[model samples]
Target chain A: MLRIENLNVSIDSKEILKNFNLSVDEGEVHVIMGPNGVGKSTLSKVLIGDKNYKVNNGNIYYYDENIKDLTIDERSRKGIFIAYQHPQEIEGVNNIDFLKTALMARLDKPINLYEFAKSIEKLSNDLKLKENMLYRNINAGFSGGEKKKNEILQMRLLKPNLVILDEIDSGLDVDSLKIVCENTLEYLKENPKTSVVIITHYPRILEYIKPDYVHIMKNGKIVETGDYSLSLKIEKEGFENIGTNIIEDNK
Target chain B: MNIINIVNNKISNSKINNKIKLKENKNICIDIIDNTKLYIEIDGINIKSNIDINIDENVNSRIFVFSNSIDSKININVNQNKNSNLILNSFYKNDDVKENTIINLNGYNSNIEYNYSCIGKTNKSLRINHYFSKTNSIVKNRSVSNNDEIEFEIIEYVPKGSIDCNLSQSSKIINLKENKCKIKPILLIDEKEVNASHSSVISPINDSDLLYLMSRGIDEHNSINLLVNGFLVNNLNLNEEEKHILFEKYIFRR
Candidate 1:
């Protein structure tokens, strides 16, 4: 489980997340829905400890241990994975090498190359990715949808205890969305303890994964926390009406 | 055979003129000492020599001198003796040493490969020029210079109608201090039928590649050494013994 209390984050002296708080329990899928530039992605980057995002004030706890002093790689090793909305394209480093290196870093040992390839191949087939992609550079020249699938591949291979997916549905076609959602579902089914924090704007992906809890964020803070019907209500009424409700409630 | 000589201004200098008409296979080792001017001419156009040298071939091989003394000059004439293969190795270490090297290839099917390594400090400048005229010939050259307060310059010219030959040139400089080092590699291609390619990359070590490796728990120096080794390994064609010797001499510096 992961917990955040009054998490304050800023980039270049501009505050983005103002006293944000959230808690994710094991085996529960939490979907964070918000409009553009409302700190949905900032929350994920803050959790992943991106150097650009400065933590001005707050505390983040992963499994009841304070991880404020841990490095980004250390946090990753401690079962925190972030499937980037735009995965980095690393040139001259092959996909297989990158994956194996990541996996070895997680396990802290030299993994068997043959078994690694076999396991990745099985995952690739499940995710409907071409096996030949492993020979190319990591994410280089990949289409937008292909890049999203590659992120899922890493998530599957690493299999962290808590996976934070930031906007995985944006650029995916219907078929790709289906495959990505199905693979995620299958992963959660296999590993029952793995928790997920899905950040998205559209409710299409929720149609497949069926999030256990949904939270609506606006202007750097979560204004509503409810069951899946909140997402359905927002989809029907839209953010314009939702904005009016937020102002009236405050008044 | 004709001999060409030019002496614009005299510093401390030396002269060498040799002609071998029938020496088919020759092993020649020429050493340019510090603060000494040198000149040599090759005659008969049929003698083949394997030359090994030490200087900074990256920048102006004319003005820069790597020596303890103030002045040095060198003049070289290389004539082909029946399509020869000339292998040259040069090294430069000081900023006060100034030297000049001029080689002329006038035989068909001849090949010249020159490799140089230079470490400069306290104002080093170098100048080098080579001319090639023949058919079915090749030239492979590379240089490495590292340090601060070193100004290095190199200019190479290849004329027209030299068919069926290729030239490859590269220069790498590692600046460990606040020294000025410049690498100018020039190639003139007048014949459209010939093939020539040149690449020059002068950059400091990449921090991202280092951090990426270090994030995986690799030692800092080991990651740097790995990247530097990868850069230099492409420059040398090393036999087992030469590779081991270079590993100890340049990399480990023992």
Candidate 2:
């Protein structure tokens, strides 16, 4: 459902992603594994049209529509959602209120308040988030795990067609990770046509949610694509050993 | 709650359980006692007024002051007696407004919490003095300026003998336009035993915050409106009705 061809991204006139390319089909799960500063998070942000990231070359196609010129909100309304690694803490905006506004904006219609409230209650319970958190400010004073869960909560509420989980496994405890993974799996089961792109450094989360293809990203481009065994090999031998031959071959 | 309308020099005889409406040019003094809640509405054209409020000993009171005026100058003074408690919430939206407010902790063990929110061209100065031991004061101010300039100067003072007093001041201004907005928080503490802190910030609405909001499918205009409303209306001790009225009259009017 999403395709990127020879994408070159930069920030502050310094290139970060060089000739990056990837494609994800509908109902497929793609996991990108890489070391720190390999443009994993940058790719996530660029996909959502982050203003700081300048697209120096190439284009992004979502269902064959060029989205390079679309604003962040436009892309979001077109069913692209990114769960930030570090979710922002908005001090005054209520969590539920923000979700409601976002849901309304995405659907471009009025919502039933009773059904909205009921859905929020059910989702919060499923995520193990406290009911009172809905009444509090968006991610303000929340624990790291709570913030991650909150992002997942918004993902469920918005129900985007393309989901980019940027380090969703970071800062989560064992139980919280299990809950998040289970909820994600449930979402995939319910919506068989939604596509997901999981970005991470380790294979800990892969144990819960298997990927259709695991791609090793190095220097802002995919160096190797393999099955789930590739993640296990990296875990055992490390990223340095797995992608050395590819880099030497390119050199 | 009684609704008392004050216009010109007319003063309501009812002191407690009242929502007082002040209009036009007027000077009024009120003494609150026996645990009460007061909602003071200030509205007029070119209003100039002085308001004085005194809280009696051991009394706990809450006051909400909402003002929607133009070209106004208002001065409010408050005094708290022994072991009294007071919570004051003030909101102002005016074209050109100047306000000076002073509060005194006159008796031991008294405490006060002051919250202020405003919009438009305003120059507001506030001072709270701890004249007795074991007193406490907390002041928080939030303002938004679109085109016109806004400035807030808040001061907290404690004398040498006012031991064990606590004081804090926080002021922030969200400048929506390329206009000059300033926040000054000053703490004058002569007592070594007192706890005092102050902080101030003035800037445009955060771009990252806006991006985060807009990434959730909210348009730029609606996202900004939501943030502005949250900054001004949230955390205030206002009922739903009062918040709705403020949003419709002042926030949405922009």
Top of the candidates by lDDT: 2
TM-score of each: 0.62, 0.92
Question: Model 2: per-residue lDDT, tens digit, A91-131?
Answer: 88888889999999999999999999999999999999999
List, residue by residue over A1-251, the lDDT tens digit for candidate 1. Answer: 78888888888899998888888889999999988999999998778766667998989999999886676677887888888887766554556756776787788888998999799989999988888788666677998888889988888888889898899999999999999999999989999999999999988999999888888888887777777887898899776555434421210
Q: In candidate 1 chain A, where is summed lDDT lowest over 10 consecutive residues?
A: A242-251
lDDT of 1 by residue, B162-226 (tens): 66666666666655343566666666566665666655555666555554443333345554544
Clashes of each: 32, 0
> Evaluated on chain B only, what is the TM-score of candidate 2?
0.90
Off by over 4 Å in 1: A243-251, B1-254
